[model samples]
Every structure is written in C-alpha cells, then in structure tokens.
Target: MLNKTRGRPRGNPDTKARIAEAARELFLERGYKGTTVRAVAAEAGVDSALISYHFGSKQRLFGQSLNLLCVESTALDQALQGDQAGLADRLLTSVTSLWDATAPTENRMALQDDDTMRAFRDYLESELLVRVAEFLGGPDATERATAAVGVIGGLIFTRSLNPIRSIAALPSAEVRRIFGPALRAALHARARQH
Candidate 1:
C-alpha cells in the first residue's frame, strides 16, 4: 500500500523565466564577477540546484541573462546582411528606428541609474558587438566592430540621455546624415599588422 501525498505543485512552470529574470537583475546589480549561482537562486526563490539544472553554470546563466534584453528586429537583421557600403547608416538607422519604437519598454525606470545602465551597456557590447565582429568576418573584424559598436553606443547614449540638445533634438534623418560617416569610418578602419 502506498500513501498519496497531495499538496501545492512541486514545480513552477515559470521558474525558468523567473530564474533568468533574477539572474539579469543580479548581473545588473553585481556584475559577472560578483554574481553567484547561489545568490541568483536565492533571488529567484528557488534552490541552487535549479539554477544548475536550467543554466548549467554561471557563465551560461550570464549569457542567457544578457539575451533577455535582446528584442529581435528583422529590419536590423536585414540591414546587416547587405553590402558593407552604407552598413553604418543602415545599422544606425535600424537601431534608432527600433529604439524609437520600443523606447518606452527599453528605457524602463529600473534601468535609469548609472550602474544599471553601465551594466546594460556592457551586456550590449558582449551581445551586439560580438555579432557585429562575426558578421564583418575578416582579419581585423573584431577591432573594427568594437569601434563601430562604440560609435553606435555613443550616439544612443547621447541621444537618449539628451546631454546635448542639438544632437538630441535633431531629426533621425539629420542624425543619420551626421553620424553615418563616423560609423562608416569605424567599421572600415584598418589595423596595422604586427
């Protein structure tokens, strides 16, 4: 004879998402070095084993957490697929348009602080710049991609932070006209071979 024990369900359907969300918040607060799986599990209100079970390891968890901020933009993907010429403009335009459309959600109050924003920026570099490097696919692709991403990040930060009224208030077209050349230079700049 076996006794059947009935109680609340032992598992949560949303645990994976909850863990990812907790990991993101912790990464933003503590950064990659400071965050731990145990801490993330505590934050997520689950056992540490669940973090290991779901994410496998801290590095994987960090990667997954960074992915949370990524909103797929077909336009951006298309922009990256064409000729290298005008890529900067296309990339910038696609990014700006997407940002404009999703500004409310992307610029949520929780990400308003400097530390959180810095963390977010670092995550963006890891996620977006790495892909940009892979897309360029050449000897100096990584170097060029870093510079290009830096240009894009600077433009975004300035525009969103509204530090300079002229740059911030300029229409998107005007922005594309002015900053496009700089991004192009970054994307195509050559590194001297050692």
Candidate 2:
C-alpha cells in the first residue's frame, strides 16, 4: 500500500522551463550576482531545491540562461576540442556559421537594447574569458584571451550593425578567411607584461 498526500500536485511539467525563464528574466533584470536561487525559485513559483535539482547551482543556471541564444553549439565545442593549432580559423568559422544560421529567425533586436547587451557582455566576460584563457594555456593566457574575445565581439557587432553593405554581402567563407587570421593574431600575439 502507498499513501500520497498533495494539495494540487508535487510538480508541474513545466517547472524546468518556468525556472529557466525566471532565471533569464532575473538575470537580465539584476545581473548574475544580484539574482539568487531563492529569488529564481520564487519567481518560478517552485522550491529552491528544484532549481538545484534542475541546474545544480546558481552558476550553472546562469550559464544555461546565458546560452539560450547559442544553445548547445556542438560545432563550437568541437572547434575547441583539440589542438590550439588552427583554433582561430575553426572557432571563427564555427561561430560565423552558427550566427548565420540563426540570424534570420532569432530576435536580433534584443541585442540592440542597452540592458540586454550589458547582461550579455557580462555573461560573456565571466563565462568565456576563463574558458578561453584556459584553452590558450600560456603565461599571458589572460591577455590573449581578452584580445580574442574582443576581436570576436567586434566582428559580431559589426556584422550585426551592418554599417557596410559590401562587408555584409560577403559570404561566410570570405568572412572567415578574412577574419580568421586576424583572430589568430589577436589570440597569438606576443605576451605583454603590465
């Protein structure tokens, strides 16, 4: 025999998504540090334990919310999988392809908003910076990583803004060919001491 006690239900089928949506909204509203698991759970109308059960931790939840645009991006992961050699070309190509595929349907307008952009930039700096620094693996890894992120961010910004018609018209291959070496230079530049 089993005994079950419930008022409404133990869990909602949409609980995970609700939690994610709440976290995303809170993160956009308050930034990472300002948002807490308890707050997210409250916003989602679930228990804090559910958040931990779903996402493990606040950092992981933030990462998942931040990645809503990119999703899994297996291509990007594959590009970063192995040798550092030709990493710039692989990374640039992967990222450009991903953006090109999603640009038309995705809400590019969200990026135009100041608050959204700031939140995204903060997420990128916190998440990508460390990953890139580790991937570069050298005495000046941090500096090179920062430069690489800047170069990539600049490229994305210009493409998004589309200030130049010709530049915008260029195919992904051409764009990759042109920017890959520049990215390489940014990532591989001689370490400068500060």
120-142: candidate 2 lDDT, tens digit per residue = 67755765666778888989989
Error of 1 at 45 (Å): 7.8
Whole-model lDDT per candidate: 0.71, 0.71
lDDT of 1 at 158: 67
Candidate 2 stretches with Cα past 4 Å from truth are 1-13, 32-42, 45-76, 105-107, 161-163
Candidate 2 colliding pairs: none
Best by TM-score: 2
Candidate 1 Cα misplacement greater than 4 A, ranges: 1-20, 29-76, 103-111
Candidate 2: Cα lDDT at 109 = 58
**Pairs that collide, model 1:** none
- What lDDT does model 1 reach? 0.71
lDDT of 1 by residue, 158-185 (tens): 6654336777677778888889888999
